[model samples]
Target chain A: MEPVLTALSAGTSVDVLIAALFGSAFGLVFGAIPGLTFTMALALVLPITFALQPTAAIAMLLSTYIGGASGGTVAAILIGVPGTPSSAASVADGHALTRAGKASLTIATATIVSTLGGLFSLVIMLFAVNLLAQVALSFGPAEIFALVIFGMSTICGLAERSMVRGMIGGALGLMAMTIGQDPIDGVPRMTFGSVQLLQGIDLLVAMIGLFAIPQVVETLAGHRAGHQMKIDTSSIKVQLPTLRFLFSYRWNILRSSLLGTIVGAIPGTGGPIAAFLAYSQEKRLAKHPETWGKGDMGGVIAPETANNAVTGGAMIPMLGLGIPGDPATAIILGGFLIHGIQPGPLLFTERPDVIYTVYFLFALSYVLVTILQLLGVRLFVQALRVPHQILALIISVMCVVGSFSIRNSFFDVGAMIVIGFFGYVLQKCRIPLTPILLGLVLGPTMEREFRTAMIMSEGSLSIFSQSPTALVFFGFALLIVAFHVVGSIRSRSAGEARPA
Target chain B: MTTPALRDRWTGLVILLVAIAWIIGSEYVIPSGYSGSAFGPRTFPTGLGILLAILAVVLIAGTFRRRDTLPPPAPSDAVDEPAKVSTRDEMWGAAATFGFLIIYFVAMQVLGFMLATVLLVATFNYFVLGSRSLVTTGAVALGLGVGVWYLMGHLLGVYLPTGMLGLGV
Candidate 1:
């Protein structure tokens, strides 16, 4: 109780509030733009947080995350293009409603439902994270090794179109991390006698490159033909849904939020998966399923609610287990590390105040995002009018500035360009980037734990199997890999059998 | 090469070579010494390299099996595929962007953050974005360069590089 009060005070400081507001506004703008994703926004915002108090920095990041997650509905509703992938499910019904002349109503309902969903998931996260951390507190080196392997396996299996490609991506990330000094031995592994290489690849620099540069290149290339759609925003205004209307779909909102939270809690599954699952479930359960692709408010509510709910759901694993479920949370994990806040089971015992502060700020971000979105819907809508090429150019400059600001190293900026080019090539090959990021985030921990477990057992492999907890996690990892392998084989055989 | 199967095969082959190179590098290039622990520093990288090699082989074998059953699609047939941008234009755009970034990086050292940023922004606006209006372009370039310098340098206390020119915040 005392911790909660202390957290409340810290989270509500004037600087923190202002940072939250700024982050939310920035996220909303970036999220509303079709090419400029919130992931890119988070990457850019990360450097700025270096100067802020930990509480204020976290507040800014959390609000940005929440706002970015929710802000996708604007473009999805108004212009038939989803600002982010999570809002792809929102577009069918959202744009349909816009075409039916209820744009304002759709936006309002999405905003309200997004807030409700975020808050709902925050409550679940608040309870579940603490409980999960308590369970994780018993984890030893072997258990942690097994658990991280399981987490990595799931990400590699599910993050991309091809499981093999995803694994390759993960391996590439792991390989990249091996370039620096060895963690335990302090022996340089692959630095090649360069002083700069001793620090290894900065995760933030890689993230900025991976997420931002491709978007910039794609935008520049694609915008040559000028595919910008002129949206009619003359009649758009915040039209709040009636209490009766919202109450009617209360069950749908609850179920979608629940689904979102569950999907988010999983290691690799994220907003798009959750939003789509919620959408399909709602469509299946609807009284009139045929109206779904048309202008059904339930469709918008389910996906919007679920996607926003992912913000909180993702935090569970990130804060409790030190496992970031997706790219955004991976960056957030980076933020937490930068603040000298090492997440995991120890965080619960060591810094309960920080945990509570996160919770309070997360909930507060929802309120603030809702207000900002409600008042600035028109502003966000106008942002969509900005040309993709210009936006790409701006983001290009930001990428330079953001990377340079990190450690003020020119080499880091050059490294970003190289990694970004590599990332672009990987994208062209249809290799998923998230698994790579997951590998990067988890690589050092995985190595340290594995080595520690080995030493504890004096090079005996049975140490991993001796612990039931470790065995269970290893079994889960094997099961996930086997499942993916079987699924891929079945898909291939089915594809072969089909008449071409 | 445009076909997914063919592309995968090429990618797999490249990755296979990389894996082999990584394994050799880890064994030869990385200094092997008597570490206190049983597992040495080179162990993880070597293991990862082997795993990558196996995965690359699997990927290549999958592509071969697919090729045996169906003819690879022609390049023209890929035109209708969604999300497949114009490769030529994309490559050119990427090259141009990279060139510009390199110039900016070099310029930053000589001209400092503010001037280098202005040049970079102006170049991007005119060349990349195709913005024709001089007033709009100049204003945006100056505004962004000055704005970021002020916000990041003066307000946030981030150390923006003041290079040989020393015209920074």
Candidate 2:
């Protein structure tokens, strides 16, 4: 109780408040623009957080995440295209309402439902994260190793269309992490006698490269000049839904929010999946399913709620188990590390104040995002008018600047470009990038835990099997892999049986 | 080569070769200092190399089986899929974007962040984006270059390289 009060005070400090506002505004703009994801925004903001206090920095990141999650609805309503992948489901009903001249009502309902969903998930996260951390506190080195392997397997299994490609991506990430000094022995592994290589790849630099560069190149290559979207701004006002109207769909809202939080808590699934699931469930349950694609308010509410709820749902694993479920949460994990806040079971025991501070800021961000989206809907709609080519050029400069600012190293900037090109090539090959990112973030921990467990047993492989906890995790990993393999084989055989 | 099977086969072959080379490097090139444990520094990399090899082989094998079982995609389907950059102009646009970045990196070392950024932005806008308004391009380039330099380098206390020209603060 005392820590919660202290954290409340810290969260409401002028500096933290300003940071939250700035981050929320920035994220809203970026999220409202097609092809500009909040992941990219988070990557750019990471270096700037170096100069801030930990609380303020985290406040900024939390607000940005929430703001970005909610801001995608604007493009879905105004442009007939989703600004982010999570909002893809929102476009069907959102644009339908816009064309039907009820844009104001849809936007307002989306904003309110998004806030409700975010807050609902935050409550779930507040309790669930602590409980999960308490349960994880009993885990030993072997258990942790097994758990991380399970996380890796799930990500590799679910992130790509092809499981083999995903595994290859994960292997590539692990291989990249092996370039620096050995963690336990302090012996250089693959530095090749270069002083810079001794520190290994900087996570921030690689993230900036992997997220920003591909978008820049694709935008530059694909953008048609002088293209402009004409939107009717006068009709796009926020009209608050009546309580009676919201009460009618209360069960839909609750169910979608719960579904989103659960999907977010999983290690591999993320916003788009959760949003689509919620939308489909709502459609299936509706008596008049025909009204779904043609401007039903429930359609906008279900997906918007679920996608925004993902922010809090994702935080559960990130803060409790040190596992990020998606790219955005992964970058948030990087932010937490940058501030010297190591997440996991120990974080709750050692820094309850920080955890409470995160909760407060997360709840606060929802209020701010709702207010900002309500007031500045027109301003954000105007932002979509900016040409993609110009935006790409600006991002190119930002990539160089952001990379260099990390350690003030020119070499890091060059490394970002190289890794970015490699990322682009991987994208061209249809290899998923998220698994590679997860592998990089989880590599050092996996290697360290595996080595420690080995030493504890004097190199006996049975150490992993001795612990029931470790065995459970390992069994889960195998089950996940087998499930994916069976599913893939069945799908292939089904496809083969069809007449061409 | 444009077919998914053909592309996967090529990608798998390349990855397989790279994985084999990585295994050799892990065994021969990486120094395994005695950590007084059975598992050495080279163990993880070697394991990753082997995993990559197995995955790459599976990928290649899957592509072959796919080729045998599946009919080819219709020409219309192939053409209808959005190309990343198929036109000549778009190809040049992609190449020029990369070329400009390489130039910016070199120029940042020689002329510093401000001048190099201005040059990169203005040239990219005029040449690649086909922006004809010199005044708008100049203003945007100068504003972005100077504004970012001031905000990041001066206000935020982040270091911006002054380079040989010594232009940045």
Candidate 3:
């Protein structure tokens, strides 16, 4: 409570409040753009944050995280482009609302729910991180490995069609991870003697290339080809949810928030899975299931709330255990490393003030986003109308600039282009890129943990059997795999028996 | 659009060939005794390659065994999807983009940064964007080139090559 008060005291200054607001606005625009994501936006701003005081740096990044998380709804509602993977589920309902001329309402609902959810998660982080850290402290390498397997298995659940294709995607990602230096050993495995390969591929460059640049080319190829629907601006006004409305669904919101926070605390799983799960549960239990994907308010609320909750949830493991929950957290970890702050158990004791500062920043960011939604909706909607060609050109230049800026190496740019082409090919083949991103982020950690476990066990395979935490995680992984397999079989069999 | 059957079979064949090649190629190069563990440099890759190969074979077999006939292509109005694109057009665009990148890379090597960026942007704008106003294209191209030169070379202290002219950009 004393730490919270100290952090809150600093937060009261107008300078700090403005900084938070400005940072959130920047994040909102960056996230609303089809190619840009929370991670990219955060990476671009990290160097700039170096010049600021520690509290302000954390504030800026926190604002960016909060804003970027919620900003995806703009693209989702307007263009059916899920800016971040977390917002992917929002498209079905959000875009339908757009088509029905309720874009403004959809955006408003998302904004409100997302803010509420973020606040809920921040509260948990403030009060419950100590308790959560104890649970994470007990996790062994075998348990972490099982968690990784569980994450990879979720790829099957996410695929649009076949589980085989999703598994193939996951395999390809795992293979790509093997291209860098061997994590356990100091010896380089796949560098081929190139000096640049020593550091392996920059995940940021790869992500921008894989996700952003491909979209640039795709947009250029079909410039102004999609339906030109006019955005109705009159509905941009914010309408607060009534107290009755809020209270009636309070349990759903709380349940989804809890679900999201728990999923987020688990390393490797984050927003999209949480959002999809919450949305599905909401629909399954609703009185009118048919309203889902057709502009139901609940449909809009569930995903927005859960996905935003994931931001705070992701920070838990990252701060307490030094394991990133997703790619965005991995990028944020780079910032922590840059600051010479080692995030683990020792961090809590070393920098309680910083932890409270971060908590203050995270909580404040939601307020920043809410203010923007009320005041800047018109400006944002107008920016959305920028021509695809111009957007493509700007994004292509940003990709080139960003890749080169990382190490001031032209070689990185070439790598970016190559990865971009590979991404283009994969996109054409209907492969989801999230699994690949997950694999890259988790690859080194998984390998290091596995090796450590092996060394400790003296080559015994029973290390997993010895630890209770490992056993529980292994059981969870097995259950997830079994559930997915059974579900797929049942679906296929049911399809086979369906009337033509 | 290609039939699902054809797509599956082709994907399987390509994956199988690639996996076998990868396995053989990796064994010859990567060392085996980097660490004392049961796994080595080759273990993960080799195991992954074999798994990928087996998965490919299963997918191909499933493609053959499954007899659920796909419905005929829907009418254009009923589909109401994004505009139907010709594969030929997409390929052409891809090839042109690749060609442009190669030209940009080589030009950067030979002609240096400033001149190359200007020419590349101009060509891309005129050729790719299909802008009719040559004056606007050239002006914007030169403007961006100078901006990048000043920003990256001078402001950021990056040592961009000055080419044969030695203008000290």
Candidate 4:
């Protein structure tokens, strides 16, 4: 009780509160801008945070990190652009609602669910940090490899036409990841002496190219607005979701929040992966599974909720152990070090004040951003009312700016253009983008872990079975594949039996 | 692709070739010596290449056996299948958009962000939107091009190419 009182009092200072507010708004802009990342947001702000008090400094970092993750939904829902990679899945259903004239409802649902999910993860992280940290550390190289495979199984759920196409997309992404220096060895496999190729294709370039650039082309083709009655979006009220309506999905919120926290705490996984995993789980559990990917409301809520929840979940590892959670949290970890605070097990006992400050700021930041999103929903939806020609023009330019800002290299911008064309072709072919993205994000990690395990076991396969964690995750991967196959067979037979 | 089945078949064959190329590429990987060597670098990519090849075969087989569904519906329309097929205007519209995108990429580097955006937006509205009003098109082009440049360069302190104008921002 003494420690709690002291920490709360310290966290309530004007400097700390003001810093939290500024961080939230600032990070919102960073997240809402397509191609700008949270890590960049943290690094950009670190210079000024040097002089502030320790608690205030840490508060700003936490708020910015939380705000950036939640703010991605605005662009994704309104303009069909993922403002941050974390919200890529949101584009699947949120944009559908936008085209259907239900943009306000979709934004409202996302805000309410995201806040609850974030708060839920914060509570678990605060109370169960110790136990979760142990489980996270136990994941060795083989276990990490198996986990990536289990994540790859999600390509099944994301497959639009069939799983085989999804595998091809996934494999292509993994192959693309092989273009730079090898993760295990320093080997440069696919670089063709351009020097730029040695650093590999930037994930940000690939994401912007795959997700946003295609929309520009579609808008030009008159595909942005579908054949639905145009509703007057300017005057619509952005109502807060009714409690009864939200309470109905209590199980989904709880389950996804838990999954988000677990995955985020595991060190290597980020919000996009968590968001997709949660989406797949919800789709599998839903009564009307067929409606997924066609603008289903659950698809919007599940991914948004899980991604926001990851803010706190990702923080657990960075704070409990010395390990950084995701890229954003890694930058925040740097912020901690700059403020002369070391974050590990000892820091919890030594500086309880700084730890509690992070918790309070996280809770406060989500509430602040959610309220901002709710209040500004009407303005955000105005994006849909803009002319297609103008919107496409703006988006294409922003895509250029986004890719350019990542490394300040002309080569990356050029790569984005080329990838945009590739994405355009794939979209025409109906090959789902999610599986390819999954492979890109997870591929390097998968290769590194697989090789490390093999070398440790002297290229023997028995290493996978020796570790209980590795064995379990591999088993889970096999189960997912088996279930996907069975489900496909049953659906096929049912379709064939119908009278033609 | 005009048809989904035909498209998937092509996609599968292209992927198979890419997988084979990837295996050949793996053999050339030379470690930079900054990191410790574990297993052979080719091991992982080779394994993935084989898996990819198998998946490509499966995708082609499935495409050959599956029924042909109707063309995908446009996002904005309600009618399941409109009588009007892909017309010449839509084809030209798509091509113009692609051309404009490439032009913008080059223009931004050569003419700078602000000027290039203005040029790109002007050309895009005239060609893609087919907007006839010069005043509206000019105003929007200038406004968006200049406005975004100001936000990204001045307000956010993010970089945008200055090109020839040397606008400082």
Best by TM-score: 1
Q: Tens-digit lDDT track for model 1 on A17-119?
A: 9999999999999898887888889988998887788999999898889889988889999988898999999999999999999999999999999999999
List, residue by residue over B1-169, the lDDT tens digit for candidate 3: 6776767878878878878887886687567755688756666667767877887887787677665266634575446644454566567556655556556656665677678778787888788777678997887778777865675555445456554555444
Name the candidate that leads on lDDT: 1
Candidate 1 runs further than 4 Å off: B67-84
Model 4 per-residue lDDT tens digits across residues A1-500: 66667778877888888878778776777677554565556644553354467777777787888878887887788777787888998898898888888777888898889898899999999886766445655677787688668657644443334666667777777877877876656667778776898888876677667666665665555532332123355545676678888888888899989988887876546788899999999999999999888888888889988998887787876677555545566567656775778666667667776777678777878887787677866654454355556656766677777677766677888898888778777766666665666576667768877878887888788888888887887787688667767877888778678754
| Ranked candidates, highest DockQ first | 1, 2, 4, 3
Residue A493, candidate 1: how far off, in angstroms?
Answer: 1.2
Q: Which candidate would rank higher by lDDT, 2 or 4?
A: 2
TM-score of 4: 0.70
lDDT of 3 at A312: 82
* TM-score per candidate, chains pooled: 0.97, 0.97, 0.81, 0.70
Off by over 4 Å in 3: A1-23, A33-62, A74-110, A127-129, A155-161, A224-303, A314-357, B68-80, B83-86, B96-119, B132-169
Whole-model lDDT values for every prediction: 0.88, 0.86, 0.71, 0.73
**Second chain TM-score per prediction?**
0.86, 0.87, 0.81, 0.75
Q: Per-residue lDDT tens digits of candidate 1, residues B1-169?
A: 3677888888999999999999999999787746555588999999999999999999999888874446675669877654566777788668767877788888888889888888878877887677889888898889888888887888788898888877754
DockQ, structure candidate 1: 0.65
Candidate number of the best DockQ: 1
